[model samples]
Target: MPLTVNEIARLLKVRGVSQYGREPVSQLEHALQCAHLAEQAGASTALTVAALLHDLGHLLAAERDNRADDDLSCDDLHQYIALPFLRGLLPDAVLEPIRLHVDAKRYLCHAEAGYWDNLSPASKRSLELQGGVFTAFEADQFLQLSFSNDALKLRRWDDLAKVPGLRTPPLAWYTDQLAQVALPDNQAVYQRLRMLLC
Candidate 1:
């Protein structure tokens, strides 16, 4: 059976319920913030949905002794883990932005385009692992690739969505919203899921 809106909402609630905070926003809250930001900024429905679910790979990672907040430096684990989750559930348009958000940082550094000056300390460290300061040829190769703009936009929302006091919407919101956009085919399931969450 296709995952029902309620079922998906429950799953997200369970999967994303963070164990800490003032209001203690779930991962769902974070996703919603990103979606709202993108929509407010005039992004396509597709891009907004992609921004909402980009960090979903973290849900599928091997349960470690600690949560993401504990270290925020799991580069190798994230790259490998994101591939399978993205391959199975995400469409190409969504997957590309999710895949490239981090890469965009590295590419920006190589291009020396002044964008890197504002990245947080964490992002700068990740760029070092991705190959600090790309050579001229590498810069060309990175720029030649498409999706930079979308990835940058998504990254911005992804950064801005981390509000400390926001509360996650009631689960019903996800069910109701997703029901409006879900297609029958399984390939559209993630899109449906995203539609609801956004």
Candidate 2:
């Protein structure tokens, strides 16, 4: 079921306070930091919203299943979990990056020197659970996916987002960004709007 923007905000406010996979920051903090970085980088509103909501699946997982991050033994597949909730609510430009960010981390471990070494301990652990570094062919395959490069950029922001005590814009700001890119995917809306010009 798709979540309302208010529902998403409430989810973050309520469940997002828990620790983010043993990272120094809470899940909400991590999200805010990633979105802040994207905004500072002059990313598109869609991309910034993607950054803000990338880890939304994590909140949903715990909320629905009552699983603590500490209780998980293996990959939680959090990247894919947010899709059903966000599919029609957000555009593919935003959704695709959220879906592919974990693979982006794997691709980075393969394509970038020192990338794996820089991963935080929690990130490193999750990477192992997420299937580790991509092979040469796997990296190429991942590159072929739409928005893979954007996912890489998002992954970098995700990695840096665990910083403690970082201040970021409130969730409301990103919710407005979400609204900006939440335009209908159908051409009808565009066609109808075009007729308004005199």
lDDT of each: 0.60, 0.87
Q: Candidate 1 has what TM-score? A: 0.67
What's model 2's overall lDDT?
Answer: 0.87
Those runs of model 1 whose alpha carbons end farther than 4 Å from true positions after fitting are 1-11, 19-26, 62-69, 76-80, 86-89, 112-114, 166-183, 187-198
Tens digit per residue, CA lDDT, model 2, 1-198 = 366676788988888899988889998999999999999999999999999999999998888788886544777789999998887678899999999999999999999999999998878888888998999999999999999989999999998898889889998888888877775553335445556753
Please tell me which predicted candidate would have the highest TM-score against the true structure.
2
Q: What residue pairs clash in candidate 2, if any at all? A: none
Q: Give RMSD to native, each candidate.
A: 6.2, 5.6
- Top lDDT model: 2
lDDT of 1 at 14: 68
